[model samples]
Target: MSGIAKTPEPPYYAVIFASQRTEGDRGYGIMADKMVELAYQQEGFLGVESARDEGLGITVSYWESLEAIKNWKEHSAHKIAQDRGKAEWYAIFSLRVCKVERHSFFEM
Candidate 1:
């Protein structure tokens, strides 16, 4: 996303995915875009922010609840992408789901 995600107040969720990419694109770009598009259509999806530098990437996707995060994990297309990531796109990855108790934002 272009800027930080605009999420609701406390009590929502964030799925933080941090990864070390493999050498080449290997279809990763297409799948990443598709996943973001699909995420915007899923129930309870809030917003997303992503960044990458060198071979490392971080994507934090906001959600209305833990169930919503779980549903996204089990989504058929996302599952396929996850498998492909393990096999070809990511050298290492970590996924953390956490409750967002509070937040702050600033703009100028």
Candidate 2:
């Protein structure tokens, strides 16, 4: 996306997905777009911010709770995307889920 996500007050959760992409798109772009759209329809979705350059990509998705995050992880379509990411899209990846106890923002 363009700007940083506008999130609510702290005490939510964040899923940090960091990856090094493989060569070529290989349907990854379409799937990624679909996943983001689907995420917006899921329960407890707060917001998401993503960026990619060269081979590296990082996406942080905000959620209302741990259970909400787990639900999204187990979502059938998302599971398919996960498998495809490992099998075709990413050269290497790391995912981290964390409790956001505090946050800050600035604008000009």
Candidate 3:
């Protein structure tokens, strides 16, 4: 082993969140960080990738099961943030969940 544990192959799900922020995002940075940390502690959460520029933000999180995704949706703090995103933070948003039947990655 190269001391770097490889990510497991196949049998995974990805939740992709794409959003456009409203006027201001004064508290969004902190809240986003908190959400990422909380997600890592959730059962079945595998990994995440996020990027933001100007007023657009995109985040993709990997999970082991649909149940885990449902649990995360029902999580209280996340619920609160979801509400805030609708009413205050996001001007527009979209969420997509896809099963990863197969995947491949390359390293330099």
Candidate 4:
């Protein structure tokens, strides 16, 4: 699966979301796809990476600033999505926000 988000230089923010899912889709896939599409439309949205295996999953979204991240969180559709996550999608989840002070990566 392609989960590589081409991020820019340092000083960006990363919102890391880790979770365990319920047994079946239960409309999670549709909501997730809508979120990805909606995120791209938001300002300061750098990129996103996502991975899932069995019941475990992780999603990382890049942003320009903490404010940008906050805005994304408060988005109306995203709020509904969050509610759905709590009610149906995620069995358990944890979220962490961090600043990218420095990073290095190379691809051949």
TM-score: which candidate is best? Answer: 1
What would you estimate as the lDDT of candidate 4?
0.93
- The digit string of per-residue lDDT tens for model 3 on 13-69 reads 999999999887768778888898899899988888777889778888889999999
What are the per-residue Cα lDDT tens digits for candidate 2 across 1-108? 557889999999999999999999999999999999999999999999999999789999999999999999999999999999999999999999999999999998
lDDT of each: 0.94, 0.94, 0.85, 0.93
Best model per lDDT: 2
Lowest-scoring 10 consecutive residues by lDDT in candidate 4? Answer: 1-10
- Taking every candidate in turn, the Cα RMSD to the unseen true structure, in Å, is 0.7, 0.8, 4.0, 1.1
TM-score, candidate 1, is 0.97
CA displacement after TM-score superposition, residue 34 of candidate 3 (Å): 0.3
Worst 10 residues of 1 by lDDT: 1-10
Error of 1 at 11 (Å): 1.1
- Return the TM-score for each candidate structure: 0.97, 0.96, 0.90, 0.96
Question: Residue 43 CA error for candidate 4 (Å)?
Answer: 0.6
List the lowest-lDDT window of 10 residues for candidate 3.
1-10
Candidate 4 per-residue lDDT, tens place, 1-108, comes to 255888899999999999999878899999999999999999999999999899789999999999999999999999999999999989899999999999788788
Model 2 TM-score is 0.96
Runs with alpha carbons beyond 4 Å of true place in candidate 2: none
lDDT at 72, model 4:
96
What residue pairs clash in candidate 4, if any at all? Answer: none
The per-prediction tally of clashing pairs is 0, 0, 0, 0
